[model samples]
Target: MRISLALLFAVVLQLPAENGYAQRTHVAISMNNVSVEQILNKIEETSDYVFFYNDKTIQKNRIVSVRNKSGKILDILDDIFKGTDITYTVVDKQIILSTNKMQLVQQEGQIQVKGVVKDAGGDPLIGVNVKVKDSTVGTITDINGNFSLQAKKGDVLEVSYVGYATKTVRVQNAQVLNIVLTEDTEVLNEVVVTALGIKKEAKSLSYNVQQVSNDEITRIADANFVNNLNGKVAGVTINSSSAGVGGSSRVVMRGTKSLNGNNNALYVVDGIPMSDMSAASTQPTDSYEGAGQSGDPISGLNPEDIESISVLSGPSAAALYGSAAANGVVMITTKKGREGRTSVSISNNTTFSAPLVLPEFQNTYGQTEVGSYYSWGSKLNTPSSYDPKDFFQTGVNVTNAASLSTGTDKNQTYLSLGTTNANGIIHNNDYERYNVTVRNVAKMLKDKLTLDLSFMLSSVKEQNMTSQGLYYNPLVPLYLFPAGDDFSKVQAYQRYDSERNLLTQYWPYSTSLALQNPYWITEHIKIPNHKNRYMATASAKYDFADWINVTARAKMDRNNERRERMYDAGTNTLFASKYGYYSKSNIENQQIYGELLLNINKYFVDNTLNLTANVGANFENNDYQSDYFGGKLKSVANLFTFGNVDTSEKNLANQYGYHLKKRAIFGSAQIGYKSMAYLDVTARNDWSSTFKGTNTGSFFYPSIGLSGIITDIFRCSTDIMPYMKVRVSYSEVGNSPDVFLAIPTYALVDGV
Candidate 1:
């Protein structure tokens, strides 16, 4: 019952202009009950001819059967459309279908044109688009980058490919042509945003800095935008947390630098440093628990409001920022109002996720006993139908956003609103977030003084976001369930208990491993987290001359978070008591930062030598507080209130806080000679409260870098090598000691 499928099509050949087609090409098809569109697609896939027609001209949805084993093209068409009013015409290599017969003959001056496309290195490029200028006639280059088409002598051919510039050339008397495309440098060469929101030319930078555009961040939607930067940059490693959806991501540049201190890159919004209050402190060397990790501060930002992100991957690039940026820096630039036409944008993004790789399991063996968890007994007569994948559901995320931007020459304004709702693969796991942002820029005092102001608010809520943890995780039990057992029996995971007079978990299996009914754990054990964040920023710049100006900026960012864990009655005694367990904590964090800077840009020696420098003073204050209280519920089932704690049993209550203040003065200068050689130097001194018990908690950092443009110095043509530079730098950066390391504090225990 083997039937060979044959491709019945014609080959590419030079034919006379008077002939409508070459010899009748025969094709063999053994399709059953397929649509006409399928047959057309097969023809196109197997032949040199392309079919062109409008949707209205063909009954693409009409179902028909064709059993042709060496039938001519015309004969097959006749049999497929015997009573239909369909007509077809064959142009040189294009087959046109229509209700009315239309004749499209080759022009008198038309001839076959052949060419090969290659890059600047003379290597052939495949999949390049080759088309006639302003015409629908087009074809893609083959494996050898060779293309052929019928065109007139005066017609133009457009050759294009991604990452390369488009090329248009007029066809002359030559029948054979060779086209070469060059890479577009304009898109690759962009201004680099460096430390403290300073702008500099890419060629003048001595250290590495990578910039990611807004489009790249929002192209694929994710609950946490940091996850989108996984594989986009070099020398950077991004590890996503096991904490299901909307979890924090760890970004490390270069490598881990600290042995017992923070190694995370500093996050700077606009020009101010923001605190990462939610980041986890435990590492691999410590007792790791994935469930304890939560979303970081950057996760609350709306991706649409971002203009670009710059990653300073070395210490030389962040020396001016002091000890906070010892590892590196991730600078975020928010979008601003542009003085142009008034516009409104609305967008919605929806995505679904599922596990692509799953572990293999042996289904031939059944458990030794009925209630045993292991499956290593006798061989099953029938293979087990139980699949761990059945316990997992498809994860979904939906995001809706809208924005309005309008402004005149003097003033501009931008406002945006966004909301996201997401569900994880595990049941009862959900995440929700909403964001609102408004920014305005104004020019006053005859355009000499400029002011910028912005405000943002975010609200987030999450429930039961399980990670790779044994406790309260349904996957642990689902994966180790006994094979050949009826999983459906556990679907009704709860039953009425007469003695306790309440609904109790209904599982007949051994509880030595702390295993519970998978369904019961998801429904009864709940963990919810909520966060609200607000931020406001204002900056004013006054220009005394075209080359010199002073700017002052201030920002305040605050966050309040509440987290709760509730265990219901009849839950595992290891994690819950008979009356159930409940715990909750509230945390508040705030940071206020302000800085004043003096910028100077001047040229000497007939504009051949240039100097750009900035001197600034910054002050930052941070305050953190936490309140926690929880205990076993008393005399009640599933009543998770703090007031219901059992007095006889041990209860927990605590309040702790810390305050940190810092002051720093920094200066950076870059000197350029003929825009070909540059020298950069930076110095910063910081005074912090963490240096208590010591003579002085102040330190100074300095860095110097030199870079030379090889191409510009030699005056070489840019075609062979567009850019070339040699750079070297040396820097001294330090990591400040943890707070309260020099002092000790005590807390009360049960009011003792």
Candidate 2:
């Protein structure tokens, strides 16, 4: 039957508020005059009477109610369904019941059939679907394709394949029964993970989206996660940097949109999008630096902590996300809680790194001058790499991580921790990072609902000691002096260069403007920058009717960054007067989202279909505050030396900035049939704070996608081949980089 996907979605909207699955029940039954043989035979003809006294089937489908009196038939089954705390409906004697109650049917004779479902090359089909013909009796194969089913010696067993033809065998007394299903051309279809954690045949979906799984994911490492898709995607460019700690990479999809605002893509963890690049809000005026010195912020996240990541690069792919997804979005899925048994996982890894970019400098002649030339006054001079001996260059770095995971059937959790340290080839130039994380998921609503939560914390420290800007130039004329006969008293003239140029002739370790002593700067010239970060999120969902569900979510991310860069008065580096400078900044970011989802399903002829609809709202706010101070003190004190109440000149100032936003509504639908064809559409509107009242209006974006199953259409299954598939996708989203752009500007002048 052809149906509007909206109708199916409306039905799914009835799911409970929280996963609402009932507990299991127990029962035992003894047959009377009607022998077990007759009951089994009658089951085939009866349409209204359903029986469930079996041992190896759906646990919930097991009938706990029993019958002792003669043929009151309907009354007996009805009583069992209600009294045993089980639920089910009897349709024409065929028990349409809940999976919570298990059913078991018994046969007297012993029939053993055991075989492996391996590929043509003899590799086991770990998860192949297997079942008995003409009945609901079925079982999935183990990872090794090894299966064991019991039936009467004379009964015939049946096997069916998803992409292969059916096979039936009459059970004999033999101990082994092996079977194989060929990879047919008529069975190629990509299965995709969709809304509300469901899997659907790709052909039925109408929205424009793409999926990548299995072998493709295992081929990369933690740091290069996004880099692997460089040339494969249609509208994405992944750029790499060669800075400290392997400058994080950037991913730009489509073209840059939005005014002067940031067009960087948004990252969603599991289902949460919360993170901040560890860069400060302010930079030195004459410092010749970017607003943010660090690379992409998302790079700090541990890739091993992720199970799968899908890029919702278009409005159609992220319609449900509203305004936050205006530029684009990446949805991530983490490992989840499982049932039945216990599994343990442990992994240890290490990596080595080297700088990809470096700066060049001229290094010849020792500390000397022209007219006022001074050899190594009191000390002997030697040729070095940074000297006339410029024939050497070197670089090195290291990183490592360790993790463990173990969980029970009811509740599962994952934990990991790691550390990375890098050193630049430059003197005293380097960066280091340490991180830890814990994630947990629980079965709060039995089989219907579940809960997921995660927390992460990390710290980064960096040091850069070089003073070649101005001031501290030893190559200055006044500081120049002649060397001693033995060059033993060079220390006296060290601060006083002999051939020092007054204007700009000097080495990197000259003065602040002329290049100060890097060794002296590293020890006395300090720019101690440190950052601490924390992130968290919590959300819940419940099903109302079989087709309806409601969800509420809240998330937060906060970070503190502080830096103190100053010059100390020491004898070696340069002659310092009284001085000190420092700055501190605090940033806070938060977001909240709420939504409702409805899913509908139907089956007819040779096809099955599904529909989903959802409504939601999102709000985000970001704020930053900074404080700066500088002064001339009595003498050069250590970092902690000068307080706000210090010895001399004072230059204190503060700056504040903020961003607020809101997004209206979004919706999308997908359709599939016979598991071969797919189609989808998505749309959304948003309001941003970066734009002013006159221009801060709403924007709409949408996209469509189509796909086909080549294998299923061609019927290629045979004895020689095993598996193959092909797929492609295209989508579009909006861009609003300068949310705070297009505003009026003003000029100010000091009044006499």
RMSD of each candidate relative to the true structure: 22.3, 12.5
Tens digits of lDDT, candidate 1, 82-167:
78877665546555555633222223455456678976645466556788998988776653567767676789998976557889
What digit string (tens of lDDT, one per residue) describes model 2 on residues 367-459? 454323334323335432332112112434445556656567557776777665665544345566677787776656543465667777767
lDDT of residue 2 for candidate 1: 9
- Candidate 2 error regions (>4 Å): 1-235, 254-260, 275-287, 290-295, 337-347, 355-402, 465-525, 544-548, 568-580, 591-606, 630-634, 637-651, 710-732, 737-752
Evaluate model 2: give its lDDT. 0.47
| TM-score for each of the candidates | 0.73, 0.62
| Winning candidate number (lDDT) | 1
Query: In candidate 2, what residue range of length 10 has the lowest lDDT sum?
Result: 17-26
Worst 10 residues of 1 by lDDT: 1-10
Local accuracy by lDDT, each model: 0.78, 0.47
Q: Which stretches in model 1 have alpha-carbon errors above 4 Å?
A: 1-186, 278-290, 368-372, 745-752
Best by TM-score: 1
